[model samples]
Target: MSGDDAKRASDAASARDKLLWIIIYSLCSSTMLVINKLAVGANGLPTVVAGAQLAVSAAVVVVMEFAGAGVLGPFEKKRIVPFVLYTTMFAMGLFSNMKALMLTNVGAVISARCCLPLIVCSIEWFFMNRAFPNARSVMSLMGVVVSAGIYIANDTGVDIQGGAGMFWLLVWWLLLAVQMTYGKHLTENIAMTQWERVFYTNAMAIPPTIVLYYATGENELEMEDGEGAMFYLILSCVVGVAISYSGWKCRSVITATTFTLVGVLNKMATITFTIIVWPKDFSVVKTLALIASVGFGLLYTEAPLRKPKVAGAGTSPLGIKH
Candidate 1:
């Protein structure tokens, strides 16, 4: 076979593998959400529950490190500042999200997050100096966001007004925008491997989560939920390890547009699963939003405007990429 043919075949295999990674990450991440809902519902204190999950993830990473498979880092001085910012964003984003969920109605919570693509895309176009997404991809992503907003508007009453919920949701959105964009930039521009990042960020999460856990107070703590809750918590930890590791790896290979759009789709999966498990009272708007979300997810996946790379180029050259 010609070199060109061999290169094409190799690229096909790699793309297929990355696709598999995205699929696994999305499924695992969606499952983590369900598991979190189950465990946190039984346990109360979302912050403390999050702390436990992080500790679980950390322990698993530690074992991998000792096995010589996922040793964390040399964590060079040059990268320290960015890594600090990365982990801070990581922890705050998650903490705020949990807090928002607790404070708001489902609608408000979802609305707060509906604009994530717009936030991430703006960052990519302006700060990162990347090309804008194609019109179709942008439109489809907008559809996803709009449908979600509509669902929220038509389906539920405002459970909390002029409260901490909106504030936390706004905070969560901004932090997550920074978290993901900086994370991709760190993996793309810096010297850290994916495993080092997975370890460091998970390690970094522990301190903040513990702080949040303590802040939640002794009164909120429940020593015993149930035997079943323990199972869900343990299972959540195992799925979480996959979620963190694959997420880091996937971001390393894709554009911000692709990563966050994939996230929108992942949310759809979680919400879909939520509806199925509980059989919630639904409105016409709610059903439409769910259906449209899945449709847009399919469209975005097929036409995801990825980062520019030279065709059949295995090694990269110096300088900026569009």
Candidate 2:
């Protein structure tokens, strides 16, 4: 082949690989909640379910490391502090997410999650010294908040039955926001490989999850046979591991814009599928609200952080207004 022909062929190959990873990422991301819902809904043991997923994921990482995947890097003592903090937040987020899934429908969870970017960006701005989002982004954030409120108002699921359900959902939302923000901090400030971060987060989360499982008396909760639920729970763990890899793989091959778009599309697909499959407490208003929330979330792009050169200052500051 000529030089141009060779370059074209490589480009085609790259595009194909990117498409494959995008599909994988979408499937894993979309289906995980439904699977977790099935598991927790059947067993009524969100703590155990969450802990099991974490344990399985950690084991997978260990196996991958031993199998010469080269995913494991040398352990650093300095990373332990941040990793532990991240793990505690991660564990709490996982449990609360499972609990929320148990109480609410998939649509409710997705709609609530639409507000996460607002919290995350606020943390970036106030605590991380990042710049505020631009005009369009700010508008989108407002839309997300409003649409999320609409969904919440219209939602008639178990979550809205009383204060406890909303409480768990709020806990999930806040902990997830903290996890995302601090996770970004870990990436920017701490020096660790991606898989190493993954391994540490998953592994360190296991102990706390175990503590929560027994501490909450989930161990004594008598579970029914729930063969189908057991299957779904196992599938949830498998997909949990798959999502970690597929998400990273997709990000490696795609632009930030493409990644964000895929995330939006995946959530839309998940909402649609969940409605079709479960159809519990489904309403036209709720569906439209979810669509609006996710659509607005799509509009919000994170403000880029840039460090300007300072004359004679020895250290560059973190972020500046555009």
Candidate 3:
């Protein structure tokens, strides 16, 4: 083969590897959500569960640091502040998502997540003035909105009509926008590697996470709970680390756009898997809603182009944008 042919083959292999990592990242995240829902929904605790995951993640980072494979870089005052803010919003998102899922079916929670592609774009437009939803995006968004409305009305998923589930979920969704934008700032301005970020964010989060957990009184209560909830909570920690690791690897290989698109598609698989494994009232409307939300959401991903470089942005893996 010609030199050009060899180059093309190498590129194709690289693309395939990235696709495989993306699939792994999606599966880890989606599976963990159902397990989280189960743990918190069963009269367990969200704050404590989040703490456990952070602790496990932090522990892994500490081990990495000891193993000389970690990026325990110098303490920069600039990144520290942003790291704190990012981790705080991240913690809030995690807690609120759990709180919402505890009260509502996982399907409703997943359906609402369809707004992410739109939300992320909206944030970029407002804050960075980078991009906005195009004609195709709007058309695709219409399908997601309509499907969500149908699900909300048809009432396939439970407890959405009443209670604070929708409210918390909305908070979770909005925080996503802030976290993503802040993350871009971190990668571009502060110069933190993915591993450095994983370590710092998890470390910074631990103190605040403890505060959030105890503040909610869940820590005190969960400590008194039965062993089954603890099992799921502990299991969620293992799942969380796996998700983060896969995400870190995937982000190194792909752009934020590709990661988000994979996530949109991942929700479809997650919804299907959640419905199959988790007990829920059967409804065709719900199934269709889940499918349409994800299927149409796929249109939001633009063709493979160079990741848009904003005037003041740096590249980083998709960290905790889920």
* Candidate numbers sorted by TM-score from highest down: 1, 3, 2
Q: Model 3, range 1-322, lDDT digits (tens) per residue? A: 9976676566567656766887789889888878888777654667777777878987887788799985677787876888888888888887887788777776577566665766665656666545555576567766766776676566644456465777887888788766765665566567766767777777788887787777777756735364477778878888988886787667566544445556766766676566656747557877777677666655553322235633432222221111
Q: Write down the lDDT of every candidate, Cα atoms only.
A: 0.71, 0.69, 0.68
In candidate 1, what residue range of length 10 has the lowest lDDT sum?
Answer: 313-322
Residue 157, candidate 2: how far off, in angstroms? 9.4
Clashing pairs in 1: none
**What does candidate 2 score on TM?**
0.71
Residue 52 in candidate 3, Cα distance off native in Å? 1.5
Comparing 1 with 3 on lDDT, the higher-scoring candidate is: 1
Task: Using TM-score as the measure, name the better of candidate 1 and candidate 2.
Answer: 1
lDDT tens per residue, model 2, 240-265: 88776676556555433335445655
Candidate 3's TM-score = 0.73
TM-score versus the correct structure, for each prediction: 0.84, 0.71, 0.73
**On lDDT, who's better, 1 or 2?**
1
* Off by more than 4 A, model 1: 1-7, 98-104, 157-160, 163-168, 218-220, 283-285, 301-322
Error of 1 at 275 (Å): 2.3
Q: Which has the better TM-score: candidate 1, or candidate 3? A: 1
